[model samples]
Target: MSATTPSKLEKMLKAGHQAVTSECGPPRGSDAEAIKEKARMIKDHVDAINITDNQTSVTRLCSLAACIHLKLAGLDPILQMVTRDRNRIAIQSDILGAASFDIHNILCLSGDHQSFGDCAAGQNVHDLDSMQLIQTVRHMRDEGKFLGGEDIKRPPSMFVGAAANPFADPYEIRVPRLAKKVAAGVEFIQTQCIFNLDKFERWMGEARDRGLLEKVYILAGLTPLKSAGMAKYMKNRVPGMDVPDEVVARIAGVPKEKQAEEGIKMCIEAIQRLKEVPGVAGFHVMAIEWEEKVPEIVEGGGLYPRPKLD
Candidate 1:
């Protein structure tokens, strides 16, 4: 069989671009079947699938290896790179390795601190934060030089992405920090799951006022809460996450059996509202275990798969 081309990911990022993307969580063991099942479910609904890098500091299969498998399975994969495990050398090597497989999309993240995760015995190796990692990729791609000042036979082509948290404390501090990432050569940004559109709009307005939105693609993140307890847990425990009081109340008001439906409705509403915002490039749905509902949410938002281009 012939290898599939990444026209979908490329077109979504390059076409007069209104894009929609989502993520896939890696399974606990060497079970490729679970990842394949989720990929098969949402493959037609999104432009690309992001394989997270040891998300929440939990041990899982390698994201890069998973991404390669997803690519081989005919899905566009964005290999999310976190600095929690690798230094600049390993990061650059992964970028090169990803390029060899024709997987070029990347998201740079600082990742969760080791203290927050179950792996208490695991040693942390955050040699570079998100911004520096993005800059390193930019240097490798644009300057054609690796961190060691070594030349490459062929420079990698990457669509660099970074993460932002609009809900971080001191809104004043959060906004400028995003500007710094954009200045550091981030090509796109996927925000943390947003439950408060009003606050997110305020932040986006501020970003536009600062002229940051004009420089890169910004995909608003949305994750459906599985239940009221999940909502509460995300609000109370998930660092850098902000679930608004009204959202919590909405979840609380739902009958115990109806919370998932209510959450999906709310997520659809969030995506619709985000589409109206001036600078939004797309939506990044972090559905977690609720990946099956992504198609429903996307259809609910009035977006459908664009016909494949010839």
Candidate 2:
């Protein structure tokens, strides 16, 4: 369905233009100024700034508040709603509240398991999983009804997006998952940081073959490695993250001081290559904490001078 909100991200995708999105984590403390600073740093580089929700199951300034900061900073904010923390009623209410703030783009996620976070004892609120959250958002926006089936006097007009990991194991399930998200009414997808292009490409090829490409926008995910240590951590420690040995070696082969530069170069190359892929609608650059390098990567990928939609 066409987006019912004023979203440049949606406008670009619907216009068949490549989108460049990036991430910004809300500080654990009440640091609204920090949020605005990060926004100004990468504001011109991305189509939308994704404000993560208690990412990794850790508590932080809430995503909704951070999105308000982003909007005030003159940047488009994508509010991430994870079902791991809130039940259906709260999620729907937050969606309405977000729309009231003129925040329209929403990315739904099941979020990381609580075990990995600092608060392991937190309740596992799976009242609505990511899939169900997507359906709920669509229902509220398209049907003008809340998840509880109550009519919304003025439903939110939101541009919906979701996340995926083409590199995740049980690899065959990737494309099928993509299909399911599209069927559930996700307008775009942001995949996990990709280091294994072969696996990602194969997944894309299968998705293309299945004709899913035409139905939804797929933004290939990219994250520049800060060091050999970071690469190793992602490969061996992060769940469902696929970082190839060659990637680790390449970063390690470089001098410790230069590893960051090497990682950035690798990210640039991936962006360039994915631009030619059949199903890639754009790129979602998850720069980790390295927001300073987003513009360099976007420019290096030849996506600078972000498109202006009338």
Candidate 3:
């Protein structure tokens, strides 16, 4: 979309500043107060809070509702939409709904498979993949038209974003895939959690060679290894996540009581190293359920005092 008045996240990226974004998940039950409490803790520490839409295929409160709650609470939220849950009709309708509540930033994703979530028998409705989803949002925002050629008088003014995995298999095609997303009109990208910096940098080099960095903002994904068990879970069970052996050893070397501290230290180091990478714009720090630790990590990583927008 041609942004008329940029969202805070868009303004920071366009200013060439190192932006910081974090995730805030909705609760399983209808406890809006709990969600608001979590957002209040880190609202000042991040450029925008990402409202996840039933992430990992687990059912939760709708992302649009949570985003509107966050918006009313005075926090800028990026409404995340997954293709697995809704068809294009619902997707576009929710996009308009989110905009009506003043939510401007959106991240389109092909969500996690249902088999991994609590319900294995749940049938997914991936009516549109990430590419088509990106195009759909652009049409609504820029063209002011629905997918079926209908027109909107005042369409949603949104800054579109998508997720990427530099560590995924057949690594040779990863950068080109990213180029394809950029070609599809994604204004920004947030990668899967990065533990293998060498591989991530290599992917960044490839993206730089293709000039994808110039076309879109790239926010390196980061998550601290909370424990040795957590590391093993990511390495063995999680898809599109690459936790290096050295990282495992670093966490394992610490005592059980101190593992979390060591993990945060490693995250801080990763942020410092990524700052020097050519195509890296900023970090999307996802502490998962450990939301309270975000402020410490952001301040420790030296990304605090997020750019002020006029």
Cα TM-score of candidate 1: 0.95
Query: What is the alpha-carbon lDDT for the whole of candidate 3?
Result: 0.90
All-Cα superposition RMSD per candidate: 3.3, 1.1, 1.4
lDDT of 2 by residue, 65-139 (tens): 999988876788999999999988799999998988889799999999999898998789999888889999999
Please write out the lDDT profile of model 1 over residues 100-125, one tens digit for every residue: 88887889998988777679788888
Q: For each candidate in the order shown, give its overall lDDT on alpha carbons.
A: 0.86, 0.91, 0.90
Per-residue alpha-carbon lDDT of model 3 for 184-240, expressed as tens digits?
A: 999999999999999999999989988899889899999988998899899988987
Cα deviation at 64, candidate 3, in Å, is 0.9
Error of 1 at 281 (Å): 0.5
- Return the top candidate by lDDT: 2
Q: After superposition, how far is residue 53 of candidate 3 from its true place, in Å?
A: 1.1
Please estimate how well model 1 matches the true structure, expressed as its whole-model Cα lDDT: 0.86
